[model samples]
Target chain A: MSTMAFLKRSPWILHYDASSCNGCDIEVLACLTPLYDVERFGIINTGNPKHADILMITGGINELNRAVVRNLYEQMPEPKVVVAIGICAATGGIFRECYNIAGGVDKIIPVDVYVPGCAARPEMIIDGVVTALSILEEKRAKMTGAAQIKDDARQAAGETT
Target chain B: MTVNEEQTTIGVALEDLTREVKALQTDGYRLVQIGCTDTGGAYEVNYSFDRGYQYRNLRLTVGPETEVPSISDIYWGAFVYENEMHDLFGIPVNGINIDFKGTFIKTAEKYPFSVTRRGGDQCRNA
Candidate 1:
């Protein structure tokens, strides 16, 4: 399949609000609204973990939600992309000094894209999602090539034997 | 009045800060921090900031009996602050929707500051 086709078919994004003040969460919803129109790009929010290709996480991972966040990350299939949304997710924002908070989301899970803003503007979120899509596309290409190369190597070995 | 001008004259009385805030909102002033401090005899209620990050501290003295107007409607951040202030000092902030069910202190009994002095001390008895 063409790279464009590969990108278009990838439908799933899981949005997890770890411990944010609901600012970034609202902005994520705004992206889905008619104004930003993220749906046109084939980016969709998924409820089930198994179906998701991208994980869009908002808020700084606090002590209460850290384990749950990590578990959700582990549940996602390989080649999955994690996008950390807002300043809280990227650097813990104003809540950074609080004892209850565990710094940023990256400390809990590996992040593929970091969207910076106290409550990140919808435009920046879209940019981050697009970046995640690009990263996903690259990974898919590498995986496909690796599988084809492995199959070819096996076929050659079989013929020799 | 814009707080960005270093110091804008806020003509309202300390107790009238809440009313002034309501008026300011009509003229466009976003509420920031609703904090308090214990001033020996009374608790000083402070409503801070004008808009965005620019801050202006307006304080009102409440001596246990006074009920400070809640700014929850103005700034959503004040909900937690009001609850925190209630938990620390037994000051009742009027018109706050959410139950200030103690975020800091667990019990309902009045203990404004730390439990420094306990009645019938074991140390004294010993």
Candidate 2:
């Protein structure tokens, strides 16, 4: 089996509440409960950025948390996915015009999926995670394909020598 | 025992602020909060205190440039509100126990709540 198979089997998620009113954060938590049971897919909720495969951000980017969001995004490994879990993370929602809000999660980091809701429902969050898994696999495939091209170039150079 | 009480607000002169806050402290009142409102370029600062479920407020209207003395010496935790007031309204607060120097709220625009809100982008290291 390829590494992509393992990637699909287990995907670690990191949830960050950039500037949410706790409405989206609560829904994100609801996804973890037995009623939703996202863990059934072998998706684990992680706190450390380095261990996260999907960044599930729940709020808009604010001046105070912009640096924090950037730091967390940078710390995550390559070929990772980001899911904007609410309208706030999608376009800063109602706070887009606020003085402090910089904008959505995409303003600070690349977002692979956007789940739209004032407070995203747990079902929607699960659906977003499922969507993020596909994006993560695509990114992983692209990375491996590039490596294969590099290896072939090296082999061709060896044959010429 | 009855716990009914009415909220009382008394206007105070800016210079008499420290003296008035000290009196409240002596009377065994705990500082509830310090809130500032921008009232047409000037500032209305309200000092809220509570003693036995009774809410009392001291209101001070000061010019935009007036320096407000910090009541942190009396309440100790008043520095939080003082710093917030200064950061949001560009109000000058003197002698805070711990001053963040306009870094209290980490807003994108400095004094964003001020009538004349001015300043460049601000970002603190995470």
Best by TM-score: 2
Candidate 2 on B4-116: residue-level lDDT in tens? 98799999998899999999999999999999888888889999999998999999998877888889999999989998988888888888899888788877778777766
Superposition TM-score, candidate 1 onto the true structure: 0.56
Candidate 1 chain A lowest-lDDT run of ten: A1-10
> How does the DockQ of candidate 2 come out?
0.86
Any runs in candidate 2 off by more than 4 Å, and if so which? A1-4, B120-126
TM-scores, all candidates, are 0.56, 0.93
Give a tens-digit lDDT track for model 1, residues B1-126. Answer: 754455443334656766777776786676666666667767777776676645566667667546667777776667877777666565666766675455443322333341221122111101
lDDT of 1 at A27: 94
Q: Candidate 1 DockQ category?
A: incorrect
Model 1 spans with C-alpha error above 4 angstroms: A1-4, A7-10, B1-126
Model 1 lDDT tens row, A53-153: 89999888665577899999899886788999999998888888865677889998889899999889999998898899888888877877898899999
lDDT of 2 at B98: 93
Model 2 clash number:
0
Task: Write down the lDDT of every candidate, Cα atoms only.
Answer: 0.73, 0.87
Extract clashing residue pairs from model 1.
none
